[model samples]
Structure formats: C-alpha cells, structure tokens
Target: DPEKLSDAIDCAPRGERFDWLLSVNINGEILSPLMWAIRDGKFALAEYVIDHLLEIRADRHAYYYGREKLFEKHPEVVTVLCSDCPALMDTLMDGLMWHSHSVNQGF
Candidate 1:
C-alpha cells in the first residue's frame, strides 16, 4: 500500500502541486515506507522529496494553505501526521498532545 501510494504521489502531474497538500495532510494512507525509511536511516531521499514539497508550497506563500511554517514549527508533526500505522499513531498522538499541552500551559 505504501509503495503504491508513494508511486502515485511520485507520479502525479507537476501541474497538480496542490495535490501534494492532500497527500501531506492525509499521510496516514501512505506513511509506512516513509517511516521505515527514516527509521532505517534512509532519510535523505524522503527528506529531499519533502523539502521539495515544502518549496512548492512556499512558492505560493500562503500560510492558510501551505506547509512551510507548519513544518518549521512542528517538524515532528510531519512524521506523526503521516503515519498510517495505528501503533505509531498512538505514539505520535500521545507525544504531540503532551507537547501541545505543555506549550499551551506555557502560553
């Protein structure tokens, strides 16, 4: 499923840059390969592609729709949000909720 999803994301038309937003937002559908790649120390490929996606969004320069600042503010959130696995989701949610709570408390 990850491979299929990754292929789809990779093969999407260049004109459909906005579609990447859907993939990034609903990453739970295709996050395993990415997580595995990162865990296995193969982050360069994933990070490079991610950076390009960020650049595409940045070129638009719209906070309400793009992901540059979001990624900058919460890089870990990317990993968590993109995870489709339930176990990983639980772990990510727990960590993210705790972090958010702490930040809110600080505020």
Candidate 2:
C-alpha cells in the first residue's frame, strides 16, 4: 500500500507532479515521508523523500509549507543528513535541476 502511494505519486502527469508530491504532508497519518524515513533510520529512503521534496518546482505554496514545516520539525535535517547519510548528498544537489517544464510561469 505504501509503494502503491509512491507509484501513484510517480505516475501523476508532469503538470500535476508537484501538486501530488507536495500534498504528501497531510495524508491523514500525521507523518510525512521524510519523517517516516527518519523514524525508521532508513537513510536511503530519507534521501529519496528529500529528493521528492526538493524537486525545485516553482510552487510558492509548496515552498512556504516546506520551509515552515520542515524547519519547524527538523531544523537540523541538513546536519543530520550530512552526518548520517553523506553518500546521499547527491540527492540534495540533484534536486537543484531546474524544472522549467510545467512550472507556475505566470502564477
């Protein structure tokens, strides 16, 4: 069922991808994907979740929520990742790939 959710999020159209990924925070379980990864000590999965989150879409809504919630709950996320999952650092860099397609060009 969890994989199914991931698959559904992945299979969403490019135009809607950010919307789907950004909505993962409030999926009725009170835990975001990254939180789950961290809770389980799944560093690789944490990297994956970080990649999905830092997808670099021009979504002000997503950006603001990400800033507030992530900083509020996991203010030391970067430090933790650096110490615990250094090999996964590429995910953070990779997320910087500009997603010009399907962005909020006007909004």
Q: For candidate 2, lDDT tens digit of each residue in 2-106?
A: 465568777876556545543465546555556566567776666655666665455444432233344465677678668777766677656544445565767
Q: Which ten residues in a row have the lowest lDDT in candidate 2?
A: 60-69
Question: 80 in model 1: Cα distance from truth in Å?
Answer: 7.3
lDDT of 1 by residue, 73-95 (tens): 44675455355333344433333
Top-TM-score candidate index:
2
- Please give each candidate's TM-score: 0.32, 0.47
| Regions of model 2 farther than 4 Å from truth | 1-5, 8-32, 58-69, 96-107
